[model samples]
Target: MRPFDPRLVRELPQTRAPVAALGLLGAAAGVAAIGQAFAIAWLVTALVGGGSLWAPAVTVATILAVRGILSATTEVTATWAGARVAGVLRERILGRWSRATADDRPAPERMLTISTHGASSVEPYVARYLPALVAAAVVPPLAIVTLLVVDWSSALIVVATVPLLPVFAALIGRHTQEATQRRWATQTRLAGHFLDVMRGLPTLVSYGRAEKQADQVAAVGDRHRIATVRTLKIAFLSSAALELLATISVAIVAVWTGMRLAWGNLDLQVALTAILLAPEAYWPIRRVGQEFHAAADGAEAIDALLADVPPACFAGRESMSVRDLSYRYPGANVDVLQGISYAVRPGLTVVTGPSGCGKTTLLELLAGLRTPTAGAAEVPRTHLVTQTPFVLPATVADNLALGTGASPAQIAAACAATGLDRVIAGLPDGTATLLGDNGFGLSAGQRARLGLTRAMLSDAAVVLLDEPTAHLDPASARQVRSVIRDLARTRPVVAVTHDPELAALADAQWPLTERVPA
Candidate 1:
């Protein structure tokens, strides 16, 4: 795993399109604003010089209408672009999650924060702040240059005070980033603790510790609330301070402009334009500061998730081999098995062991779910079947296909191999039977058999089974073992089981027991 950084949060499909559109929109908006300023100056001159007002009035109306249309178009485009970026980001996150290890899965609360609050927090910034930021950069400079041509003093005032907004924004941004990071950490912790407590509710109740656990949850919630309030306070203060600075700067520029007008150093039209445009210069900086705070939380969560993604290991030889392989759980002092070696030729081998003797762990090692802590293990291609099968919410045929795009006939053959053909025939929809929510409607045995069928459908060189028959009745268990035996005749099968009958049927068997290391 490498350190997480925001740069790695895959680029969105709409990134380039939105950026280009925003640039064009900003240019158009700047032009429109300058035209509006020029129109205002002309209208003022027309009224004062005792000329016809109708021309200036019509010009003002035209500029306003054009500006309005451009603004609306920019807004709509920004909204669509932001939504598309968000969708891309979500898909990338889920894709990375699927490739991550079991241990890499964030605590339930952290997952919720990322999926819900973190995602929502970034929306406005992407859609509104980004495009507005581009416009601000362009419009302010053009407006200030127009003022400079009319009166240098007003332009100087606007220029000198404008930099203060960004300076203040930088300082505030630093503080906000720190505060947001802390707030995000606390939020994830609170969520994780709540989920952990909920998951252990039965145990807590059994031991008469439910009240104690409730107090702990309350304490965690209180801490999270405090952190949230602190973050909000900092965010609000930063926004207010930036707004005040911009406002004061604009006011000072306006007052200076008014004095120049009174002294006849500048005309009324130029003074009015400068005053109207002063705030526009600082608007973008202030908006960016506000949006930075909103995006900070999501960035922090993404950082945490990305930091744990494991680096890809080199795929060497095509076939897998095992030599004196062993593993131990993290922080454990002893290996579960000692100096175990095996070669899985293209056929069935069953591993029989007592409870807590590392049968499932062995299957995981063979399936590439975990690497050996000592020695080496090799696998060409493999699929695994656990006691509790995971059934995705899809058609029965899809479940068997396992995203491999296997044909209907192939799926049927796999199902038949696992003795599920009769089960499918009995269903009203046959292969199209909907497996809802982890296959809840199906019995445990049915789910297990379906899982076995899916593994068969995978067409891997090796199939690893971890107690595939544990949930079945005697008749069904025997039938499944017979099917497995038949399949093993063609390709290698490595099964971990406690069933003596299954072990006896294996061409070769390995019994795992606690023993001294070699």
Candidate 2:
């Protein structure tokens, strides 16, 4: 997208308030700036024509002061508005991301970069570039007309060279965009690599290969640094070139004014006013060029993120159905389950399978985390309990409630159903005890029981359990099985297990085996 594209600006929702404020501020600033210019011209004319300068001096100072105040206020308001807009956009991006595919996550990091650094950098552009550009557009024409009234030759010189500034700015912008894209790509690759390394640091250290991996990280960082330097160099060069163009244009206008002054075609007051206004005409273009580069990084970041998560139509309230379901790992020759068929009713169902026989895959399929490549699987609302339960770093009660706003009675009922009543009773602070990371302070059986309790507390109609008793002792496992069997009386329970006690407790059992493709 073009750096100054209106569509890109419109994509940000927060731009509306600032744009409106900018229009008002621009008008005020333009009038003030032009008023100050006119006052100076009048004062010069008065002094040269042998008239009083008091009135012109007062007008110039008052207008200049008001312009400064407006400029500061506009900067503050525009910064606040831009921050709000960027925050809203970032939230929307994340909300959309929750539904994105695994492949879509990495690219969305670009959106984060834009929302943070890009949004912050663009504030100056809005407060300064936009208002200045407006002033440049309006004030110059008005100033030129005033100069024409005094002397047509100076006005002609001002109009002739003003267009050069924007032309040069556009040329510089084209080069900057390419350089920024390259730099952004390098940063994204580095982030992905760094995240991967952090996630696998434990394994790398255990294998005594952490030092080798550190070298790889350093190499990635070096490449990122080089790309960053290249981007900065291009930006610096472009700014310098644009600045030079504006300066040269102003100089040419100055020389013409000097010639006119020497000839008697222009008075001293008219000549000075025109010279002062000459740089003002190019100032907006120079500011625009600078702001464009700053905002370009954010624009590029948004583009990369949006590319990953293209607008998608959500399947609204559609019930899931599966039948004769089977799945095999990619590149694996054997099916995880052969001819597995089941209709899951709306209630608790325990799923049991032999070790490494696709039990977790089946639960993932049921929970809509994975799609089966073979057969049909039908499910409505689902909650899955794995052998090792995940307890977020939070209070025990919060973990059990899982944000459902379940009443104390309901929470206790769930605990009882998961055979956790005794466990909670034993705690010094029942339901409020802090479970550290991974519930490390709790025993394996306690964690498993808590996982089951959490799943039970959910409002989901169907619940799948994969070896819920895997970590429990024989007595605790028997108690859990009994509790589960009691739960199945009202809900469809599908438990996948090789445990004979659990199998006998289940209403039905379906054996799973790897099947070769025909």
Candidate 3:
């Protein structure tokens, strides 16, 4: 992606209000800066000419106060805009990933980097670089235009040299683009490696290979440092070169003003204003160039994120619909669930099949979590209790709240219905116990009951269960089956279970078969 991608700017229409406000604040600050320049110039002229200095001093102080307020506002607004844009992008990225199949998503390590660290990098880009960009757009032109009106000769000198900064920076950038790309790739790989090694440290230690890999880790770390330093070196060199060019440009204007002032060809106040404004014109541009290099990674990351998340489509409102459904996994030779047609209403629909008949995939399709390869499916809002349901590290209330909103009584009722009331009651704080990681203290049966309880509490019209009874004993399974029976009374329920007891209660039973290759 281009370092200053306009699409990224476009992607942030939601952030336009704050960005626009920041720009306005920046423009106001620039105007105040110009006013300060004139005030200082007038003070110098008055002091030298033995005139009254009170008015110029007061003007200078007033401009300084306004500029200070503007600067603080710009900083706070920029910080807010940065955080808001990053959060918006992350939410969209995660939403897309959640709606997509695993095959469509980036690898875990890369996704984590983009969503966490990659998202964080945007803060500096938006806060520092964006504000600099606004200043560059506003201040330099304003300074040059003001200079043009005050002293055309100095303005001409300032204008002649400012373009050289960007041209020189671009030249340096072209020379280092390849090296920078390589550095970024290496940095990503090393970062992923560090995360991977740390996550697998226990496994490596168990195999007596943890210590041996320390050398590899150190080697990768050293390479990353070297590459990062090399990139920073290039960046610093470009900044220095731009600075030198800007300094020379300002000096040229200064020399012109100085000679004119010495020869008595220009007024003292005008000459001082020209000198003051010349540096402002050049430095804003140079600052932008410097910040662009610092913000390149975040810009590219945002571009990648925007590319990855396509526009969303709303789910249909049907209770259930399937016609000639077929699914062939990526690179597969044949469909897994081929030419299957089924429609279900608000009742118990038990689906039974041999181990490899794509029963779970069918449920996923109904839940709108996967698309059929060559069929039509319409399902309303759905809740799927997977074979291994998600159990988070949070309080029981928090975990249950992950489902549809319910009062304490409603939650307790759902728990009792799903045979989880006893587990909650036994906890130190009923419904408030913090399950460390994945309900760490809970048994498999308890997790199963919890999953079912949440599903029962969901407002979805369709609830798909994938082997929800697998982890339970006979008594618990019977209790859960009773809960499923009650859930079916309100909405459509399709459960994939090997338990004959659940199968017997089904109002309609679906027997699935694997698709055979032609």
Candidate 4:
């Protein structure tokens, strides 16, 4: 976006090491290549004049072997650097959004693009484009300098023509940038549309609309194909033009060197070496042009991600307090939550509410997951058990111990307290059992209890539970309510539920209605 974004170095400090390594390796490799060009010329000259060739041949082989090793190293390091850079960028993005409210993050479709395929595309830019950039920087200057010392006539021709590569590339980009941007926008939308539709296909089928979208999908696919082909055609033509320019430039140098050789102004070795070194100056710049065309999408993605900077949050307190706070969604005319005052200390506070009255919003506010609109919240480190808790396709132990340093004994103790120990014991592998998303093979009650178990193991000063016993039977509900009581004895506990049994045991109960609020 900014040609070469300086913020990439400022923001992602981890990338500096690999990029510097590439630059250094490129310089070293360019030096070796220059030496190898002379060695190759000397070998050819020896063969032509019937001179002894062993020394020059060995020199050429050794330089080539060194270059080969450097090439392999460059390849591996570039790959590692690409994946590493992409990984760090993705981590920063996901971590930022994980701590942000719904108002701050992009839609799910765009977020999916940023975290997955978008991150994947950056690998090519780093592995290919960056190396080419280093080569274009190091090889061309070094080659031109070597040519100047060997013969200024060849150097002058190279210096004069190399500028045309970037100039031609710039002209091509200026002509196509608008179309490229439009096509890329359409490409992103089409891809996101297909993915979103696939994810919601079941819902669409239930609503009798799935079959209707097939023609739309086909139409979008065709449009994407046409746009992609057009973009590729421009890209290929631009690259071809640069290649042709480079070839003609190199030919000019070769013909000048040959003319000087025939006139006895230059020896065969210098003439041959000048021709070999001349091409290196042009190709690195040309390769850079090709890679830039290929990597523009990744560059744009990086720009998009870096522009979204997340804020820092500190732990406020180990209690819940909100005084006359009101919150509205961004760009909304009405408030999702009106002026409300609530406070909680070290005890059980049960909030009962009907649907869509900002119950979960209040809990999120208390957990420091969202900021207040017009007031302050003195909420502390909190462990919240949402109605639908996070479930990973990992072993049971991994799920329970996620984001906590709880040991096995502590995990088992918490599980026992929540009556989930029996569920884990009944499984074939106990705490090692593998689960699918949302805990497949486990009932909703078990999932809820597992979530409760995880919450119980948390070290947070406050615990927030959302319908912890919604899926459980009477007996299991009683067991969980007992665990809730046990949890309330030591720390501040906020439970959002409709169960009378749990409410009866609460130290406080606030109903969410027009007359009263929590």
TM-score of 2: 0.79
Per-residue C-alpha lDDT of model 1 across residues 200-305, encoded as one tens digit per residue: 8999999999999889889988988888788888889989998999889889988898887889887778787777777667776777777666666645644543
Instruction: Please state the error at residue 128 of candidate 3 in Å.
Output: 0.9
Measured over all alpha carbons after superposition, the RMSD of each candidate to the real structure, in angstroms, is: 3.7, 4.6, 3.2, 2.8
* Segments in model 1 whose C-alpha atoms lie over 4 Å from true places: 1-14, 47-50, 103-112, 201-218, 302-308, 311-318, 337-339, 395-397, 421-434, 515-518
lDDT of every predicted structure (CA atoms): 0.76, 0.69, 0.82, 0.84
Candidate with top lDDT is: 4
Model 3 misplaced regions, further than 4 Å: 1-13, 100-104, 172-227, 308-319, 354-356, 513-518
- TM for every model, in the order presented, reads 0.87, 0.79, 0.88, 0.92
The TM-score-based order of candidates, best leading, equals 4, 3, 1, 2
Model 4 agreement with the true structure over 1-518: per-residue lDDT tens digits: 43466777788999899778877888888889889899999999999999999999999999999999999999999899889989988998988888876656777667876677678878887888888888888899999999999988899999999999989988887655656576657766777788888978999999999877877788887887888788788889999999999999999999998888899999898899999999999988899888876677678778766767455354567667788877776776767777788888677899987877778888877776677788777677788999988888999989998988998889878988988989988999988899997689688999999999888888888999998889999999999999999999999999988888899999998677532333
- Per-residue lDDT of model 3, residues 199-253, tens digit only: 7999999999888778788888788788878878888988988888888888888
Clash pairs detected, candidate 3? none
Best-performing candidate as measured by TM-score? 4
| lDDT for residue 478 in candidate 3, whole number 0-100 | 86
Total backbone clashes of model 3? 0
